[model samples]
Target: MLFKLLLLGLVIWGVYHFFIKQKPIEHKDKEADVMVECDKCGTYVSNKEAIIKDGKYYCSKKCAGVEQ
Candidate 1:
C-alpha cells in the first residue's frame, strides 16, 4: 500500500518536473537586428525591410526614387 503510494507520488513528480516545471528555451547570444536610416527622409527602419538603391538605403521605393 505504502509502496504503491510512493510509486504514484514519484510518477506525478516526474511528470511535473519534465512537462510542467520546465522553462522555455531562450537564445542568449541572439543579437538584435540592425536598423538603417533613409537617406532621403532620415527615417529609421529595419535593415531587412528598408529599400536599397545606388549604394544608399531608403525607407520606401518612392524615397529611393524607384517607380513602382
Candidate 2:
C-alpha cells in the first residue's frame, strides 16, 4: 500500500511539474539596449525611451523645452 501511495504521489508530482506548474520567465537585459544622455538634464536613458529634438536626445518633453 505504501509503495502504491508513493507511486501515486510521484505521478501527481510529475504531472504538476510537467503540466500544472508555471514555466520559468525570461527577462530582457537593460544593458543590451543602447543608452543615450539627455542634453538638458544629462540623465542617461534608453535610446528607445529618449526623446529626440533638434539633433539632440532628451529624457522628457520638458527637458526638450516643448510647451505641450
Candidate 3:
C-alpha cells in the first residue's frame, strides 16, 4: 500500500531504535566506596569492607580484635 506503510514504519522505527529504545549503560567500576566508621560499633563500613585496626576502622573481625 503506501509502500507497505512506509516499510512498516521503517520496521517499527528500526525495532524501536535497535531493540526497544535503548537505555542501559550503568558502567561504574569503582568510585563511591569510602565509608568506614565502626571503631567498634559506630558501624558504617565499606572502605572496601572495613576492619583495619590500630589506626581504627572496624566493622568486624569481631570489631577487629582479630580472633576470626
Candidate that would win on TM-score: 1
Off by over 4 Å in 2: 1-32
How well does candidate 3 match the true structure, expressed as C-alpha RMSD?
Answer: 7.6
Query: lDDT per prediction?
Result: 0.84, 0.86, 0.80
Ranking according to lDDT, highest score first: 2, 1, 3
TM-score, per-candidate, Cα-based: 0.53, 0.51, 0.27
Clashes of 3: 0
lDDT of 2 at 35: 93
Q: By TM-score, rank the candidates, best first.
A: 1, 2, 3
- Give the per-residue lDDT of model 2 (tens digit) for 1-68: 99999999999999898764444422235445689999998999999999999999999999999889
Candidate closer to the true structure by lDDT (higher is better), 1 or 2? 2
Query: Model 3, range 12-63, lDDT digits (tens) per residue?
Result: 9998877544434222324658897888779898988997878888888987
| Cα RMSD, each candidate | 8.8, 8.4, 7.6
